[model samples]
Target chain A: MNIPKITFIKMNKKEYILIAGLLILGLLSYFFMYNIEPGAMVKIEVSQKLYGTYALNKDQEILVKDSKGVILCTSEIKDGSIRVKSSTCTDKICIKEGEISSSGQTIICLPNQVVITVINEKEQIDGVLK
Target chain B: MNVKKLTLIIISSIIFLSLIYFYMNRNIVVAQTQFIMNTTIEIKLFGKNIDKQKLVKTMNRAFDIMKEVEDKSTSYVEYEGNAASLNKHRGEYYMVNQDLIEQLSTSIPFYKLTSGEFNIGLYRTVNIWKNATDKNYLPSREEALNSIGNSTPDDIIVDKFNNRVKLPEDMEIDLGGVSKGYALDKVIVFLKNSNIDIALINAGGNIITLGTPVDRDYFNIAIQDPQSINKILGTVKLNNGQAIATSGSYSRYYEINGEKYSHILSGNSGYPKHLYKSVTVITNKGIISDILSTSLFLLSIENGRKLIEKLDYPVEFLYILNDDTIIKSEGFKIEYSQDNLYKDE
Candidate 1:
């Protein structure tokens, strides 16, 4: 069997610190970033397809469709988080889904064909659903 | 070194190693995964611009798959798609998808339990309503009466002897509730196999999420308040491999005499019902998610709950009653937001 090269190059202090800091950031982000509460809205779009006008709820629901007959989606603003609620399609995939409180979260509806992204509508979210 | 110093040094090294690991995995968050269509269509994956032309194309492909099933399964379409193939063998035939066949069969029982509130047939009746709205032509009273109630599910045969569907000529099957959900399932599998760890698929209005949010464990979903168009009652939290589907009367309906009739037709009346305002079902199965949402809407809240209880499908429910009382299943604990726009009841 052939052995590949195994070399250890010392990383500079800044490089080591930067890497360590990044790992801590990731771990903290993983455990603490999304302390989810139910019915948090992640994405909101106004789609005309569901009803006359529909509103997206925190359970990824949409209660209203616009008067224009398009499903209107808007993120539910709450003290906790955001989500996509109502949509204009027969299948209610959005409503059954709960909430994501993370900075970057998203909900997509393929039927009315909309995407709800969680961002700090007040401040930029830490990540994107993408 | 003393014991305290030794422990501190070891912990520091551990932290340093973890840092290097995270740095090495940096680009994974933004990496673009493969896009697939039902293993039958191809959709591109781009995190940016979900409405972009490419993403739309993928969505369109998912629609195509839905349409294909509709074309094949719906008696309304006239062209014999798979639905016809399955239906033609109704009584004596057991379908390869015993799961689908069984779902329909059990759903029939639900309709019976709901006093035909949740039906599997009535394709002919469905046509009457569809034509009434689409072509501005309601079926003749005689036509409406004759087309429906001709064949009960008991009369229909599931021929296990041969994989065929059979029904009285007057009666046809429509997978309206399950078709889109089925399509969602297949699409998710396609996405998963393509090594796409994270994705969201919406079939018409049904949404299914695979994997976690890019930066969160739970995905936030909104629930529409029944009375208001621009309001949200609450939100649902979703984790990896979870799906949410809602069925409400607010979306598709025709109004008559100051009364509203939704598209969720009543199997018995051959018209829509004033059941609960809406019912939302959360489960992992997209097909079940779709059917149950529609089915529960058509069923009485008690019967729907009974149906859910009998099944072990990891199901939970939320019901908005006719009186607008919000009822959550014992299992349901969706956090109510501070800005909850609608009355919980």
Candidate 2:
């Protein structure tokens, strides 16, 4: 049987400092990058334009109108979740899409050309990969 | 080492790591939304080294293709290349566009596949219901039954060589269910040809995806509850190149005397099927998924399973009953929330 000798090189002072600095830098970046301040607001867009941003904490009913001032849909925010109450669009698919409370969730009414999305500081992923 | 030398080395190291971090985050997504085909068309492109202007141009072209498909297939659009022309020139070989020819040809096979339950030729029946719904009334059974004529696959003749089509007399075609899927397929092909690797196209209940997200293995799709519009039934993770279509009675229905009449009618009775609250089908093709969703909604679980089992590929399905007992196919790997009562049947 052949015996192999293992060598252990002690880390130098500069190497230790560099490793500590890199670890701290990584931790700092991660803390800043992933510290998701839970979304406090819901943004509504109609016809590809920004409609309005409403606070999630507030309970209110918003009448989403089109460019011609025609009331397209009514959105209600209650208990931190927002849902479409009614819509003038024939299908009313938006109303059936249900309520969305989590960040990065979206409710889209195709017929009315409306999109309701929840946004927070940490939520940047557009959609889940399929 | 000297203090000045140590500080300079640390600064240089920080700069090098910053460059690496920036390089690692180079991948970005460019998304655009447009209104076309009676719905919002949103196209997203995920890539690192992408031509922004070229991708936008491709997206515009994709929208134009959707508009073209809508024009060629929709009975509502009264254009030169519209499918309504086939109805107008019924019993005669009317010159039609290639798009209409493709749309009709692709959908005609499904009429047989779904046992006529998902018929596109019932435009008259749909019109009667629409008129009645608009007036807030229910259409009579006799009126609905009389409207069904020459609404089968055999009645619609496709003269492929001459680029013409002939429909039976007094018959009108409605591509309401399949048009969105057809348009989605067209847009997806255009995107693929444009070298777009990852994209998602949603036309209301008809959704089609091309590739996986840059960091995810699958896309998360939530199915909403029909009884309660404020809740979701479950979440389905869709694989790459998969399509899902949902058919439900919750929308596009009229209430009369506390009873609901949905828009999806059955060829057997010419009345909307009231069995399931919603049916969602996941398959390889959008048109197949769309037709199957409607067909399954009108069918019993045993019959629906038999129909799907005969197909070449395995299709996953989720059916939510009126009583909220969820029934899913064996292959359907969906995660339901705590509120749902579900089992893989």
Candidate 3:
């Protein structure tokens, strides 16, 4: 039978300092990367252009306008949800769609070519099927 | 003995490890939303090694493919050689693009498969309802019944070799039910050929998944409640290469004299049926999922089951009745939202 001898290497003060510095760097990076939470925001786009973004926490009404400065639709935010109050389009589907609070939900007025979506940094659902 | 050299090696290793960590955690998701086919078409691509500019180009091409399909299949607009033209020249053989030819050939069989319940020749009937809705009047039952002339698959002739199609003299074709799904299939093929493995395309309510996401086994899809806009009924786990489509009467409707009529019309009655409030189908092919969702919505639970049984491949379905009774296939798993609005049957 043959016996194998195991040796252990001891680290000095400089090596301990390097290890501690690396750990601190990793922790700082992790916190900086993920700790900041931007609340849910509503993104309104007109004809594929970013019209504006508003915080869901605030209760306000957003009037969407086209290139000619014509009002297309008015969306209202209340109780952390948003809904289309009125629109210039023939079909009131956008108004009938009611309120949407969760992320990834969209209110699209095809005639006006406006799309309003609620966006959150950490979206729970990948997509919503209507 | 050389402390500075040891320190240099340790610091370099830390930097190297950090690079590896960041790279390993980098999962890029590129998504673009465009309005095409009268709905929002969102294309999402996922990967670890994605070139953002190249991915955007691919997405644009995918949207172009959908636009081409729409231009060819739309009954509202007339292109030089498309469905609108074919509808105009009914009873005469008219040459068309090969894509339209393929769509017709693929969809004509479903008309017989669903026993005429799934029909593409409802253009006239659809127009009647559209006009009625615009004028805020209810079309007479007799008018709807008369508009559905001879619209059987046997009446439509497709000369595949010549890329020509001829509709019956009285029949007008509307590819609304299958065009979006066909476009989805086309885009998926284009993406796969472009070496895109993970992607999700949502055209209106029709969704198709490519490979699985980087972090999850399947995509989490939430089915919206037909009764409520803010609430979702449940979530379905869609696996790779699977497509899910929902046909709900609540989405688009015609309201006349305080009554709501669904957009999905039945071939027999030439009017929307209230058998189910919504029907959802999950299948392997996007076109099949689209066709079945509409067909099953018009069918009874038993008849739909029989139709599914006759098919060679597997299919799962979910039905939400008027009374909020939820019926689903055995293999279809749904995580119901914690709401008492719907009851599982």
**Which CAPRI level is candidate 3?**
incorrect
- Candidate 1 lDDT at A62 equals 37
When just chain B is superposed on the true chain B, each candidate scores a TM-score of: 0.72, 0.89, 0.93
Q: Where is the poorest 10-residue window by lDDT in model 3 chain B?
A: B19-28
Residue pairs with clashing backbones, model 3:
none
The DockQ value obtained for model 3 is 0.23
By TM-score, who's the top model here?
3
Q: Which interface RMSD values do the candidates have, in the order shown?
A: 8.6, 7.0, 5.0
Error of 2 at A123 (Å): 11
Model 3, TM vs. native: 0.73
The most accurate candidate by lDDT is 3
lDDT of 3 at B141: 86
- lDDT minimum window of 10 residues, candidate 3 chain A: A30-39
lDDT of 1 at B3: 98
Among incorrect, acceptable, medium and high, the docking class of model 2 is incorrect
TM-score of model 2's chain A, to 2 decimals? Answer: 0.63
> What's the residue-level lDDT of A99 in candidate 2?
86
- Which segments of candidate 3 are over 4 A away from where they belong? A1-123, B1-25
How do the predictions measure up, each by TM-score?
Answer: 0.58, 0.70, 0.73
Instruction: Provide the overall lDDT of each model, using Cα atoms, as 2-decimal numbers.
Output: 0.59, 0.77, 0.86
lDDT at residue B16 of model 3 (Cα atoms): 75
